[model samples]
Target chain A: MEKVILIKYGEIYLKGKNRKFFEKTLENNIKNALNEFNCVVSRIPGRYEVSGFDPKFSSKILSAVGKIAGVFSFSLASVVDSELEQIENISIVETEDLDGTFKVVTNRADKTFLKSSMEISRHIGGLILSKNKSLSVDIHEPEHILNIDVRENKKTYVYVSSNDHKGIGGMPVCSSGHGLILLSGGIDSPVAFFMMNKRGVKLHAIHFHSFPYTSNLAKEKVLDLAKILAPFNGGEIGVYLCNVAKVQEAVHENCNPDYMITILRRAMFKIAERLSKDKNYSMIVTGENLGQVASQTIESMTVVENVVESTPILRPLVAFDKTEIIDIARRIDTFETSIKPFEDCCTVFLPDSPVTKPRLEKVVFEEAKIDLEKIIDEAYAGIERIIIKS
Target chain B: MIYLDNAATTQCLDGVVDVMNNYLKHDYFNASSVYAPAVKVRRDVENARNELLDMVFASNHKLLFVSCATEANNTIFESATLRSGDKIIVSAGEHPSVFECAKQFQNNGVEVCVVDLLPSGEIDEEDFARKMDRRVKLVSVMMVSNETGAVNNIKRICKIAKKVNPRVLVATDGVQAFGKIDVCVDDLGVDFFVMSAHKIHGPKGIGALVYRKDIHISPLLWGGGQENGLRSGTENVAGIMGFFEAAKLSMKNQKSNFEKVQKIRDEFIDEFQNSGVKFSVNGNGSPFILSLSFDGIRGEVLLHALEEHEILVSTGSACSSKHSDNRILSAMGKSQAEVLGNVRISFNAHDAYDVKNIVKIFASTIEKLKG
Candidate 1:
């Protein structure tokens, strides 16, 4: 019997007019993912099916499918014609090894088929029971449920399980737009990268590595995190490490102690915005959880956000609680590397009490104490680009 | 590439690849099978084991060939039976395999204590004496430091440790010292020893744990009853053949290669010293390994800077380089600043590694970095 992989996506069904565009992009992505292998990815109405490859590489192909962004769930199924006899034969052959109670689920997209969905399910289920006399049926809670998805074009998919992998369950990356994501070696930033990536923005990640004060291990930790996030990117995710030590040093030396984090954040935004405009990025993404710390407060965030108004800064985790963000971090395999106690540039020369509520006008007045342009220019000059490919 | 990072791992010798291919392609047979061809492969594996034993003058020791040095280290710990009050003293600067394995014992129930290292990165004799007690069942130390290359006085340590308690078993990690220097398990008086093939000039994924015949050990991985029921897994036959070849070559060429590598290492050191760069040699270590530290420059940054000029070196121990900090350097009482600026440059006996060219690269790289 011939086997094929059935891919099901959830959100593109709601795209309406742009639905065709999303489907085309998904097809192109699946092709690129399986480029090394000899397989063909085709679209049938609302779903995509992968076929014509060696069955031995099914697990390998499924792993590649899971790395894709728009995937909801994928399944390996036996493909046959819409004829009832053919479906029954294949179902019996597939489920001959399985024991205990069982049921058959049928999704008949082709209305012109001779039998109704109920009739197909009962027919396939009865054939399976005939092959294995010891088995019975359970509708609500069966030990096994064989799913049969029938399309309008005389093609039918039969599998033991419908849901093979629950994907990242977001829009495909690079569909939204391009963004300059300011990544840090922390618990929240990598999660933010995934969150923004889920929303379909191709990320140009920038990490501010503070050497001498902070070690290269800190930068290595960020690179490791980015490697985990790279599988979801439509293209390779290359990170730029900018030495922002001079800017942070200037903030600590000249700015008021209460305004230390506040000013450092403003300087970072200025550099990120400059690079964003320089690189033609449409947005910014940060792992800033609202009110998680003094600098993340509504008033403090405003003072920092006010500086980089040219580009839209996307803080995906702003409304999320610490525990909620951590839940995602652990799921994505970034928690252990993120928690390594290597200090980044932000941790150096920290203030005793950073300003939780500072006016933009006063922040501007404090910023006049140092030359932002000169320090930012120096930091920008030292930007080292490292490409991380999955 | 001016690859001076031989201590990290070595490229296989010229004919070692062909030797490995011969076994892998033609003589592929499961040694456990009772067939004629299988018996021949088993004989070849046993011959390799015998050759390895003879190299270290360990004819009385029973050798169990494993996949990696880490696996060998873990197998020794698995072999030892301990009670709740039993103690194990491991050197603070042992590799992650031995260090973490000892910690696992501590977690289970054994009283594990860490003996300190001197500033030169050798296991401190006084600290070892202090940690020795009737409850201590095992004392583990490395024959040579992988990071700093400080050759430990294993003979003196075994003598001192035996005086305190004759029953305490001594195992030495011989991965770094085996091929680089002269090694004899009997002369060193170590009960158990671990060594890997790639550390010399053989293929990777091949290491052996040679223990005395009277000392009992169990298998960490239980599979087919191979390696005399001590380690039960399919023998890595091709790698063992490569290892046997590399062991023979290394033993035959140890003295000549030692003189040549030491001379090259000294020349490179003199070049750095003459260039007026603010650098400090970390430890009086093995002549083949040199650990240098610049006053204010980060070792990682310097390593990358040198890599731009095609010189490959290392910053700290590669195994735990991604870990937050250097536990070994800190344990040796090196200050935070010195530890941060450390880089290890190791040499091997290869025709491509010219002493004059490597010395010149070191001088130019240091000059560019300093300027």
Candidate 2:
């Protein structure tokens, strides 16, 4: 018997008029995700079924489909003829091992099928009860749910469950717009990247790595975290590595030691804003959660946010707590890579105690100590572009 | 670049590399196949194992080459057939592989006890005597301390342990001792001993566990029958060959190289003292390893300072540097400031020729850093 996965998505169904466009993007993404497995992906109303791939790779396809943002869940299913007897037999086999009270949900997409959804559920439930004496029927709350999807094209997919893959359900990538994330190698930033991508923002990231201060291992760690989020974008993560040594040197030489992080973050925003303008990105996203760290406080974020003149700043994690960010990071599989202990550019010269309530006026005054234009121009000359393959 | 982190790992020798490259280029057959070509590869694997055995002079004990010293340590520690509440003792300064595994056994209801080390960084016999009881099932101590390079009296420890509890099985991690010093499993009377090839100028991923032939060990990795069913995986043919060649070379040059490196190590300490720096050595550790600490400068900062001059060094054990504080060094009673300033300068035979020149750069780097 041939086997396949029947995938269903949530939220996209509520788009109404633009549902077609969202479905098209999602289907293309699912196909791209499983392109290496040689599967035939066919779309129907409210669902898509993957077939022609080897049954051995069903679990592989299931995991791949689970990563895309539009995915609600997927199931390993067997394709059978639409006869009620065929459906009855498959349903019996699917729920034979399940115990306690159970429920059978039958969705009839085929109008010409001989039985109503109620009749089909009753017949299949009777067959299952007779075969397994250990089970009782419970429509309200059941220990196991055997789902039956009866489609129009003389095909029925019978499975014991539905939508097992709980993904970041929002919208499809590239469906909303394009933006850039200041991808720092930390737990919060990668989760922010995943959250923004879930909102349909196609993203390219940029990082500043200082060689003498930060090791190459630190850079490798950032690229690794990006790769974990690459599948959701349907390709590799695009990153631009900028060397800001001259900027850092200028700050250390001229700026106050306590203002190191404050000035350093300002320099990053200045560079990011210029790059955003050149790339035509509509906005900038950061992993800043309110009061989570010294730089993430209201006073600090406002100062950093003010450096970028016009591009809107999005802090997806602003309302989230550290555990919530970590939870999302763990769900996206980027948590482990993010926790790797390597020095990022900002961490190399971390102050003993940074200003928690950093006044913008005072920060602006500290900025006057360094030659801003010369540092920016010299640092911009050292920008390096690195393409991270999935 | 000048690499001084030999205690962490070493560059694979050209001879080992040539052997590995030859295996990669032409010999691609699985050793388990019944074909003649495959049988020849199996012979090569056995030849490698025998060569390793010869280097350790443990013909009576069974030697199985596994993957790295960590695996070898785990295999030996798990071989002990101890029930819940049984006592097992390990030195406080054991490598993470042995120390961590022993601690985990406590979760499974085994009574895990740690014996402290002497101020000189040697295993404290008084503490061991106090810890070891009649119910102790196993005892593990490294042959040489990886952090301090202190030569552990494994022979004496095992002798004392067996005298106290005749049924106690003793195992030692021989990673730091295998190439730098002479190792004979039979002479040591240790039931189990482990060594890694990388520490001895071989590959990074291959190591061996030599144990008494009568003991039975549980296999962690199970698949098609391999390594006499103790470890079941495709024989890492290239890695095994690399390990074999590296072991052979180390055995041939162990004595002369040890003496030559020892001279340079002494000179390094002498020159540093002559530079008039307020510093002190950690302990009378191994001659190959020189652990020195400056007064106020952090080891990591000094490590980078030397790196600026194209030199590489490590601060304490490289494995534990990032994850946590050096528990072994801390347990030896080194203060916080001392621990932070502790830098390890381990020597290699190849680097011994330029010892004076490297020491000169090191002294200047310190002055530049402190000036």
Candidate 3:
């Protein structure tokens, strides 16, 4: 009484040339799913078989395998060695109660098998109908169908039906290169990180904390955000906190108050770009929504863009409204921590009336007054790195 | 490190940890089991219940354990509205669990009315009184707001609700106020009260709902007849014991703790005032929680700045922090930028040392940013 669970791949079969990749993926998925079942999963030619388990665990293993993503369907089957006399006996036993219209589906992958697929199907169908007087031969609308699959390795699998489940399948996080996220302990950045993770991009978060200007709760909020992002990225997320108060102070003393945000954003970009380059990240992800604030305006954006020479800046939520962003944040569970009233560095040195739109020439004129590189270097020097675990 | 996010969850006291560890290691038993060890666990649970009842001055009320304040709130609202057409009136500043649960009644044809909050984050008492009509079946208000820390006049509101319709039940979400302030359920004359263990230095997954003895409500879960047949699941004996110990500790040192934290809050506020920082306190109510808005700086930026100093505070209630629009602050009519720059600093009785460090760090950061 050798019992085996026969499993079939669903959508993976649709891939023509890349079928092997899909098959391998599905095989791995099934193996992982059946890991707790303590069964040996062996790959046969057209399908896979689960063996060496208690016969009673067959139904449970089949149901579990069917639910894994990349798996199309599965069935509980009986495995028998390739022997003509044994096949005939097993077929007789399997078709004893086939008291209805019947059809036989056979796959003869094993060329060594003397019986052809058509010959096997016809013989099995006739034998099943002869056993029960009420059964009629209906090739199309068969009430019950028997399946006989022969593999190249001289083995035969007989099963009735296959069952299917959904999966959270995409590329694993970090499969794509990493990106540095300007996580601002607010709703948008964490949501942005979540969005990026969904697309398989791993993240490293950088938080700008203005101690003495903002409370430690603000920093904790960023850390909390990092922690929330951790599980999705498969483990710990690296977080770097930079003290921007000194830079902001230098900018306020050396530059115009209205240009404070512009100067600060440029400095942040410089540091992020430098770190991104250092950490081998291809881009930077920010929570900046266009026109959401003075610094987020087109002019301000252009001014800030002028500072970053390397790495493309990815603003995933640039077009999304606050409501839309918040909705996503709520769905991802970051809305709660984002709504906490922790002040970040951007709030610490905010000018009462920041330039929502400023001429490029005027921005350049203002930039000339401050030691831009020095400020960024100073802020970069104060960077405190914390690796967050999932 | 300074921790001013007590409203989100507090650090446990040594006594709470000791009590919880003792229960976890030595008294771990299934209360429903017939063994003597189980019986002892049941007795301890009952003893803790009686102590809590006495502390709240609600010996007559029935206390039921829940996972958290969210579960407690959901159970009450869901049970109360089991009958169709029951009207639920809630404050606009109510916690999401309460507000959302009340809103859900709309699907069952139960009318939900939201009472507005004043600019000070206090409920408009007159407005609430006017809204209390014969159709209202329940009035749910939070005793102290998790975000603004505005203490509502629960006694006054309950009185008004009862005056309009004696059958109108009053439920108070006391997650923020329970341990920090003295909450005498009978003194306030509420029909139901909810509190979370984590908010008062206990474990995360335990909370309680104290229902008036005579209030008729249906059970949410159908299982073994546990929690007086309200919530039916195996008791989290360890969490409950920890909660009791934390509650006891909070009650014992609440006054001195309050005074100590209040001084730090005042000092922090004074620095902002002296620095000519253009800011406004969200609610002019309790000193336990401070919602400060600094003009020019985004709240997130300030949050990161403070993070550099190893200080931990929040922008609002941790639950609602991830959203950009501060519904609590916005309900009080704060401008978009004003709401964006707002930060919440909550203190517990045990946070004096941390509070001083927080104030010093905050002052210096502001000075640096101001330069």
Candidate 4:
């Protein structure tokens, strides 16, 4: 018997006519995740099987595959010829360390193998019980279930389905179209990136930094967040950094101080839209939650997105509460890096009280006070693209 | 580029780098091994230790090399045999390494007395004397205020503590004072002294804790019994050699370097005064570091503005820059505006930058930021 890993999918089965396309994308994603490991991932009839890897690297391989989206469940099992004695021997070995009530489950894909599914299970269960002398059969809520898959490839695979080996159930990355994330070195944007990545959106990021007002460390912190999210996006992410210090300086000098964040955000969306068009991204993703901050209010968001007329602005985290967003951030391992205290562009010329509900006409009037279009063009012209490789 | 953040760290001298490279590339022998080359390396380490001890006039004390000043300071607290009822004293202006340790001990039910800081950034000697008692087991303070470069009278503090309780251990973190000033641990009367290499022109990751020979402190790490079983790990042979070279050069030119730094400091201050900016010197102590407080401008914004001209400065101690509140400045009773506007510009003894340009950039940046 040869040791192998079995991968299962969830949402792709419902794709109907687009199943082939999604399956191909998932296979490529799995390959990318496990690119460092020497192994072969082969697509069988209903699942994918990974073989020819060193036994010492089994756990490492399993962990890398577990992070890929669309993988419903996966298991490390041993494959043998479609024969009863071989299956029974492996099942007995699989239950050698068990001491509680157990059950044997058999899936007979090759009906011509002669023994019925129940017959094979009964034979395997009796043999495991006879050798171990410590197990009893419990079909309902068994402590351990020894799963047997007799496939149409004339091979039977045996593995114990562990509840711990669960996958992150979502569509595979790159299944959806590309978008640009307005990533800030804050708690929300990286989490927004993660949410969209889980929904199969291939996302690049644009960060606005006000150096000499903000610091280089803030830019680095946002880049670090992008690096942390790279693994979920096939092991690399491209981030663009635009210095909005002049834009901020102009607003701080000319406009009312309270509209600093409002006007600054409008500048950011304009730059993001320009870069997205230049790079062929169809949407602009943000982590702007409703009423989380002054600039994130429904009215404030309305004023911010009014500048981006060409592409759709997606706020995946618009309805999530702060605590719920933090929960996902912690789960995705971006919470710790996200909370690093560095001043972002928004905090550069922050006023004492920002306008929670901004009128679109007043914001446009403020925008007219400064040469915003020229400043934004200059900011976009100085964009620094950093590729964080996996 | 002009580097005025010497109090945070200094660039290593070319000669020190050569010595370190020799040890790292050729004489890479484990000091604990029983081979002839290893014996030679151990002998070299001992010689360097003696030389460093002589530099501080601490031949009567035993020195234990550690990772850095932070580790040495932490080791001092970790080796203290204090219990619930025992009392320790630390200054409010102490570095976070010493101040935080005292706070943690207080959390574990130790009686911690924090002496206040005078407006000149010096430790309040009267308050320190008042806090001294027979119940105090340890007295910890820093030799210099890293925030304002105020040199404390460690000899007097040590005498006061010992007179109150002869058994009390006196430790001083001399990271900012060792090579910058004339450091004589013996004359200072400190029972335990901490020093780092990088503050001078030595390599990072090497510091030494010198203690009186008769006093015995327990080990924080137990491994291969290196450093007299106190700090048990492979000896940092290259770093130790580099530290010895840096200390040697620093002492050789200490008197002349002091005069040079004082001259530059006077020029910089004179130029700032002539530039017509209304500013106050936070603490009037050591000429090596100057802390200036502008009334309405933020120190952080000013620091970044100066960077536009390739001049590096710090708003506070590098360790406390990320923290909005400056504990040292606050302990000196400065107001919130003064604390927020304070900037620290330090000078190395071997500095070779033009002082006029720095002040010009400083004044212009402040003017622009104010506007």
Per-residue accuracy of model 4 over A1-390 as CA lDDT, tens digit each: 788988889999888888999999999998888777789988887788889986655655776776687888898999899987888888888888676788988999898999999999999888898999878888998989999999888888899865237887788999998999999979999989988888899889999988878766577678778876888877789999899999989998999999999999998999999888989998999999998889988999999989998899999999999999999887776886688777888988889999999999999988899999999889988999999865
Candidate 4 lDDT tens digits, B213-292: 76766888889878767789999999999999998898898888888888888887898899888788887667788898
- The reply for model 4, stretches above 4 Å from the true place, is B1-371
Residue A338 displacement in candidate 2 (angstroms): 1.7
Q: Give the TM-score of candidate 2.
A: 0.56
Best by TM-score: 2
| TM-score between model 1 and native | 0.56
- Write candidate 1's Cα lDDT for A247-270 as tens digits: 677777887867877887887888
lDDT of 1: 0.82
Residue pairs that clash (backbone atoms under 3 angstroms), model 1: none
Looking at model 2, residue A274 earns an lDDT score of 89
For model 4 the TM-score comes to 0.54
Quote the lDDT for B279 in model 3: 85
TM-score ranking, best first: 2, 1, 4, 3
Question: B1-371, model 1: which lDDT tens digit per residue?
Answer: 88878888898998899898988899888776645577678768876887788678673466889998999888888877766779988998899999999888888899998989898889888988888887778888998888888888988888777767878888999999887788877667778999999988899999999997678787777776667666787888999999999888898989998888888778777877777667777666677688887777778878888888788989867787776477888898988877888888888887456656665666677667667
lDDT head-to-head 3 vs 4, winner? 4
Candidate 2: Cα lDDT at A275:
88
